[model samples]
Target: MARRKGNNRKKTFGARDDRNNGEWTEIKKDNEKWETYYKAQKFIPEKDWDFFKKTCQTQLPLTFRITGNRKHANEILDIFKTKHLPQLGNVEFEGEIIKPPVNLPWYPDNLAWQLDVSKTVIRKNEQFSKTQRFLVLETSAGNISRQEAVSMIPPLLLDVEPHHKVLDTCAAPGSKTAQLIESLHSTSDEPTGFVIANDADARRSHMLVHQLKRLNSPNLLVVNHDAQFFPRIQIENNGKKSFVLFDRILCDVPCSGDGTMRKNINVWKDWNTQGGLGLHTVQYNILTRGLKLLKKGGRLVYSTCSLNPVENEAVVAQALRQWGDKIKLVDCSDRLPGLIREKGVSDWLVYDRNMDLKTKENRGDIKESCFPPTKEEAENFHLDRCIRVYQHFQNTGGFFIAVFEKNGETQKDAVVDEPPKEEPNSAIVKKMKTDSGDVVVTKKEKLPRDANEEPFIFIPSVHPELEKCWKFYGVDDKFDKNNCLVRNATGDPTRVVYTVSKSLKNIIESNEDRMKFIYAGVKLFVAQRSDIECPWRVQSESIPIMKHHMNSARVVECTEDALKVLLTHAFPTFDDFKDESLVSKLKELKTGCIFVSIKRNDPLKEDLFLPVWNGSKCANLMVAKDDTHELLYRIFGIETTRNEQKKPQQQDEKKEEGKMTENKI
Candidate 1:
C-alpha cells in the first residue's frame, strides 16, 4: 500500500536525513534570501509576512479528496458523512485539539476535506483508528485520494465536461489527471470525450498509467513525450482528416515549488531568486503550447506551486503579450468564493542572482520578459485576474493560477518535426502527419523505443466467443460491439478483451503507426475456466461501465449482511446465505461469474455492484483481499478476510517489496 500522506501533504522525492544517536534532527526552516526576495515583491501585506513564514515552517494538515467511479465515490462519502463524522466530536490529541475532518467549502459537493493530525498519531492512536481504517481501505480500493487540499483546485476549476476533449500537459503521479477523468464520466457512464495525459519522462509516464489505470477510464491515454514538443494528432472525420484541438487544457508546469515549503523541507533550504527566473522561459513555453492546442473559445488553466512573481505573473505576462488579443486572462475574483487568495501583482521588482535589482540599463543576462510589464501593458492585459494563494491564507500551501480562454483564430500553428521518416517496421508509427501541416520525422525517431505495449487490434464483433458471452450476460445492442478490442497482432480474443471510448478508438486507429500510446481501455472480458455457458467473464473493474448495458434480470440482489459472509469466507455454499430467495436465484442460474448488487439500508440507500464466481453449490466474491476487507469493515464493522490466497514460500510473511514510491500530491 502507498504510505498514508500526513495531515499536511506528501512529496514524491525526498533526501535521506541524518540521525545522531538514533535521535532525529530537524532542518532549520529560516532562509534569509527567501525572506528578502518575497519582502521586495510584497505579494502579501507587510504585517502578514511573519505569519506567512511561520506557516511555511510548520507541518501541513492531513488532506484528502473522495474520488473514484461517481456512484462508488458518492457511496463512500455518504458512509463517511453520516456514519463517521458525527462520532469524533471534541477529541483532543497531544496538546492540540484534533477536530473531525471538515469539507473544503470551495470544493464541490463536499468531496474535498482536511483535518489537523499527523500520520504517526493516526496509525498509533485509538481515537483515530476508526477513521484511519476507513481512509486506508477506501484509498486502497481506489475510492479515496490523500492529496493536498490545494492540489485539487486546478482540475476542478478547469470545469471538465463529459464531452470536452481534455489534455493534462505534465501529468505524472496522476492525482489531478484522475480528477479530470472522473469529471468526464460524471454525467454518464459512457462519455464521448477523452483525456491525453502526457509526461516527458518515460518512467513517469508509466507512473501515470499506474495511478490512473485503477479508475478504469477507457477515455484516458498516457504517453511519453516532451511537453514542449508534444505530437500533433489528427482525427479522420467525414472521409477527411483534421487536427484534434482540445476543449480544456491544463498546464501545471514544473516550477521552483517554494509554495510547498510547509510540506517539503528542501524547498526552504534550496530556494533562491534564480530558481524562478531560470524557469520563467520554460513555463511560458508550456502554457503557450497548451494554448495553441486549445480550440477557439476553449479554456486553459496555467498554474504552479511557486510564489515568485518571476515564475507566476511573469510567465503569464509573456503569454498574454505573444497571443495579443487572441487570448485573455479569465476574471476569477468571484470564483471559489470561500477561497482566500490575493490578486495578481500588476508590477514587481526583478533581481539578479547577486541580489542586485535588474533595471533596463544594467540588466545583464535577465530576459526582457522577466521585468515588470509597462503601465499601459498591465491595463490592457488585466494581470490582476490571476490568482495568488498565500501560505498563511487558510493555512494551506502557496499556489498561483491564471485562467485563459482563446477568443479568435491564430495566423499559424507550430508543427515540430526533424526531417524524414524510415519505413515503419513496428506498430508504433510510420510518420506523423495531419491535414493542417506536414510532420517532420527523423531517421532515428522511427519508433518509440521505451513503450512495450502490444498493438490494439479489433476482433470481429460477431465472433463466436463474443456471441456466447453477450448472450449469457444479456448484453444487448445498447453497447457498441464494434468497439471490442484485443492487444495482439492476429485480431483475436486470446485472453482479455478490452473496450475504449469512441474518441480514443479513433485516435488509436488513425495514429497507431506513429503515436506512443502506452495504455488505454477497461477490461471488458477475461478468459474463464468453468462449467458455465459463457467462455468469457465480465471483469469486476468494468462492472460500473457495463451495469447499464446488461440486462437487469441477469443481476442478483443480496442483503448487506449476506455480502459480509461472502467477503469473509473463501467459498461459501448457497445454503450459507440462509435466505431462500438468494438460494433460489443461485440455483436457477448457470454457474459462472455474475454481478451481485447488494441492497444497503444505509443513509445513501445505493446498491453496491460487485462480481461473484458462482459454482454448482458454492460461490465466492471476486475481489482482491484489500477490497474484501474494505467492504467487510465499512458495511459490517468487520475487518480481515478469512480466506487469503496462499503463497507457500512466504506464507507467514506479509506483502513487502522495496519498490514503494511516495505520493507526490
Candidate 2:
C-alpha cells in the first residue's frame, strides 16, 4: 500500500517564504530582445502582449495525464481523489486562500491534473510530497507518464480510433506516441489498427522503444526514417500489394521551441528572430510529405511547440497553396469543449535573417518556396482554423495545433511540383544509368544493423513438441500459432518465440526491402531444454494474455500466506509453505511454470496473478522483482527489505555452485 502523509497541514501558494527558497524562485532573464521582436510583429494582439510576456517568464506548472486502457488506471485515479486531494487542502498565497490543484477541464474525465505551485514548493510541502511520490511511483510502473498539459492536446484532436492506421513522423522521447497507442487501444482488447512511430535519429528512435515498451501493446512498430522523405511502403492486402497510406498522421515537426521558454529556461538566453526563419523550410517539407502519405479523406494533424508565426501559420499556408484542392484545414474549435485557445493569425510580416522586411526588391535572396503567402492567399488558407495555446491563459506550456483533412483526390494526381533534389556527386552519377528503359539508382549506403539479425522463422503449430506442450498446458485452441515465429529456423533447443499481428507481419514481410524496423511485437515464449514436463515455457511478460486464453487446469489458487511466501523467496522448498495442502498440491504438479492466483479479500484490492516454476527440490517465482515487491506489500501486510530480497538470489547461486561440485565429484 502507498503511504500518505500531511493531511492536516495548511498550505500556501505565492507566499514570500515560498520565494525565499532558492528552489522555488523563478529565474529572471532579460526579455527586452523578445519584447522588441514581439512589438514589431502583428500576429499577437496588443491587448494580450503583457500577460503573455509575464507568463513566459514564470515557471510552468507541473502536469500529467493518467494512462488510458490499463487495469490499474481507475485505482490510481481513485488514490488521487481520495488520498492525495485531501492532503493538498487550500493554498494560501500572500495571506489569501487560493484554489488547490485542479484537473484540466478540457481533458476527458478529469484524468489530466495540474499542480499550480512551483516545483520547489511541491518538494518542500509535506502534502505535496505525498502526491508527488504517488505520481513518481506510478510513472515508474508505466501506469502513468509525466508530460506538459499542452503537449497532450494534439493527439486528442487527432481523434484516433482502434481501427485507424496511424503514423507519428517525429516521435522521439515519445509521450505523444504513447497517447496515440492508448487511444488506438481505447475500445478494443486487440486493436486492428497499428501505429508506425518514426524518427530521423536512430538513437532517439531506440529511446522511443524504451519509452513505449511499458505499454506492451503488440499494435505498435518503431522505425528510423527522415520525416521529410519517409519511404512509401507496400502491404499485401487481399492478395494484392497496395501502397500503404495512414488513416491519421501526426506531423509534430522539430521546431525552434520558443513556446517552451517557461520549462526550458535556457531558451531565454538563446532567443533569436532568425531561429524560426531558419527552420521554416524543413518544417514545411515534413508537413508536405505527411500530407502526401495521408489516405484520401483521412485526417492529418500539424503541430509545433514554437510560437513563431513563421513556423506555425506560414508552413501550413505553403502546404495549403501547393495542395489546394486535395487538402483543407479542419475546424477544431468545438473538439475540446473547455480548452482556452486563441485563433491562428493570418497576417504576419516575413523578415530576412537580418530582421529586415523582404519586399519584392530584396526578395531575390529568398527562395520562392520560403516566401509567405500573399494577402488573398492567406484568406483562403483558413489560418483561423488553427489553434494557438499560449502559456498565460491556462498556465501551461505553449503549443500550436492545426488539423487537416485530405480530399478524395489522389496526391499523385495533384499538380504539385516536387521539391528540388540535391545534385549527385561524381561517384553517385556513375552508378545511376538507364537500363531496360528504367532509371536504376544504385544504393548509396548499406542498411544499419539491429539488435536481432536472425531471420523470422515461424514454428509449425502441428509439430510434435509444440502439440504435446500445448495439450499438457491446456493452451487455448483459439490461440493463433501461425503468428508465432521462432528465433531460429532450425530446431534449436532453446530459442525465443515472438508473436506479431497478421497485419503487422504482412507489413514487415512485404516491405523488408524498403523500410528498416527497429523493434516489433512482444516476446511470447522462451524454449527451454530440460528434463521437465514441457519443453516450452511461457514468459512472465506474456502471462497477461496467456492467463485469459489458457484453461485453469494448471492454475493453483493459493492462500494469502502462501502467496506472500512465494513472492518473498526465489526458490522455496516444500517445507517453506505454511499450509500442508499447498505443499501437497504443488508436489502433485508437473515440473514447469504454473499460474498462481491469490483470492481477494478487500473489495478495493484486485487479485494478484503470478507464475512459479516447480522443480524437483524447490520452486522459483518467475515474476519481475518490482512486481514481487508490489504484490507482497499489496496482497499481504508484508514489506520486503533489501537484505531479505537479496537472500533468495544468493541462495540460488550457492545451490548452483553445490550442483557443480557434486557433478565434479
Candidate 3:
C-alpha cells in the first residue's frame, strides 16, 4: 500500500474496537483504504488478492519455538507431543472441525507450533487453557519462547556454527539474538564462537540483556551501537593488533513494520506510504556497514518486517550497486522446506506525495531513493534471490530476507564517505578518523571494567588459598588458570572472578583504550567469607561450562530422596533429610558450594548434576529459583508452595523487626 507523504499529518493512536465481545471483531473489520493499497501492488498475483486481504484482517495464530540448547528441550517436546497433544483432540469452529495443534512445516525439528484457534477460543476451552498454562510456565522458565514464524527465518538462514564469530546488528527485545546464541551452542557444550548483540537504544540493549540472560551462555556479549556506524575492535594476538571481522552478520534492520499487521493492529491506522521511503537510507547504510564488518566468505542476512519493496528490494539493490563484486545474494529457496514465499520484484511503481503513480512529468516529485531499478539493472542485480513472505501464503506475518555472501578479498579500508553523525545523546563514546580513512566508533559502557585501570590479574598456580580451593573441590591442577581473571590486581576480597573465551580475552586487553566493555563473560567464581574451608566458591551459573573440566573432591553423588529435599528447600539442615547415608556423606564435605549428582536407575532417564552450597550447619541449593521449581516438580511430583519458599530478604526482615523491638525496649 502506498502512503502519501505529509508534514502535518494527525498522529493516529490505536484504539480497541471491541464491538463484538465473543471473538476478534476489531481485526475482522474491512478497511478499504488498506485494501486499495494492496490492489496496486504488481508482485502480488491478482487471484491471491482476496485471500491476502482476508488474512491481513484476521488475528494471527499464536506460535512459539522450543529453545534448542536448553537441558529440558527434548523433554519439553516429548511432553507436548505425548501429553499435551493427546488431550487437545479436535476443535470445532464455524461448523468446521479443526485439527489439533501442529508443528510449523518450515521450522526445524518440528519445534515451532501454531495453536490454529483464536485467543478467545483457547481461553474458553478447559483443555486449551491447561495447555496455555503449561506454555506460559515454560516460557517464563525460558525453555520456550512465543515468536512469529517469519521472525525465526533469518537466524536459520544465517546457519550459525559453534566456532564462528557472529553479530546481530539491530538486536533488541532479542528473540533473534537468543536464537543465534542457541545455534552457536547447539552442537557444543562450550562454544568458542562469540555473539555480539548490538542495538542503537541503550534502554532496549538492557532489555536485550534481560531476554538473553535466560540462556546463560558465556560466549554471548551485549553492546549498544548504531548499526549504521558500528565500531571495529582490534584484537591483540601474538603482540599484533588485528581488526575483528564477523563470520556471520544478521542485519535485521528497523523498518516500516507494515508486514506485522496481523499481530500489531495499530499498523492499519498508522500506515503511510512515506514510511518505507523515509527508512530506505538508514536500512541501506546498516546493511552496507554490516557487509564491511563481515569476513571474507561470511554470510550476512538482511531482513525486515515490512512488505514494502522500497524498504526491502530498493535498499538491497543500492548495496549491490555500491559493492559490485564484493557481495552477491545467496539463493535460499531450498533451505526452508514447505515455506511459501514470493521472489523479489524487479519492477515497482514509485508513489508521489499525493499518492499518484509517478510519471515522467512528475518523477521529480517522488524521491529517487524510492524508485525501482531499470530492466538492465534489475537483471544484473539478481533480485530474485531475495525471499518475500506474505501473510496469506503461509498464514504468517509479511517479511523480506536477502542473504549476501562476501566474496574474494576482504575490504581492509572499507569506510563510509561523509558518514552521518550520531544523535547528541547517543551512547557512542567517541568517533575517530583512522589512518586508513575509516571511522572507529567507541561505546560508552564497558563490562568488567576496573575503576583504577588495573591490569587483569590471574589466580596464582601455587598460592595457598588457590591450592586449598583446588584440593577441596578436587579440581585438576592442570586446569588452565590463564582464562580466569580477578577484578582487581591487588585481589583484596574481590567479589567475583570471570573466565572469558580466548578471543574475547584478546579483545578485552587490546581494545580497552578504544571500546567500552559492558559485560564480557560468565562469572567463574565468587568469594564467600562465610566459608572459611573454601574461600573461593564456584558460581552456579558456571557449572555448565566447568562441569566437564572439574574433577574435584567437592563433587558428590546423592540419592533421589536427598535430591528431592535439596530441590524443594532453600536451606535444608541435616535433620531435614530422610536418608542416613546422604547425611553421612554431607558431614564429610567442606563448607562451600559443591557439585551433587542424582543418578537415575531408569535407563530411559538421564542423570542430573546440580550445584549446592554446604554451610556450617545447613546446605543451600545454588540453582535459580525457576530451575529449582521445575526440578522439584519433575522429580518428586510436588510443586513448591509460597509459604515453604524462604527468601533471603525475609530473614533480613525478621532481623530488622527484632532490632526495632529492642530499640523500643
What CA RMSD would you report for each candidate? 7.7, 10.0, 8.2
Query: What do the candidate models score in CA lDDT, each in turn?
Result: 0.78, 0.73, 0.73
TM-score of 3: 0.83
Q: Model 2, 123-182: lDDT tens per residue?
A: 766677656766765675666788899999999989999998999999998999999989
Alpha carbon deviation, residue 29, candidate 1 (Å) = 1.5
* Model 3, CA-based lDDT: 0.73
Q: Ten residues in a row with the worst lDDT in model 2?
A: 427-436
Top candidate by TM-score: 1
Worst 10 residues of 1 by lDDT: 656-665
**Per-residue CA lDDT of candidate 1, range 1-665, in tens?**
12333545643333223223434445678889888888988776799888888898898998888875555678788888877788766677776667677888988778888877777777666757768877877888888888887888889789999999999999988988998998998887788999999998878988888889888888888877678766777689779987788999999999999989988888877888889889888888888888888888899999999988888888899988888989989998878779988889878988898888888667899998988789999999898999888888887998999999999865374344522433566332223333434443222222444446576666556666787778789897888877778877455677889988878877877765566777888889988763457767888768878887888455888887678677766666676787789889888887677778886666554578888776666666778777877877667766553344312222112122111101000
Top model by lDDT, which number?
1
- The residue pairs that clash in candidate 2, if any, are 12-92
- Residue 374's C-alpha lDDT in candidate 3? 74
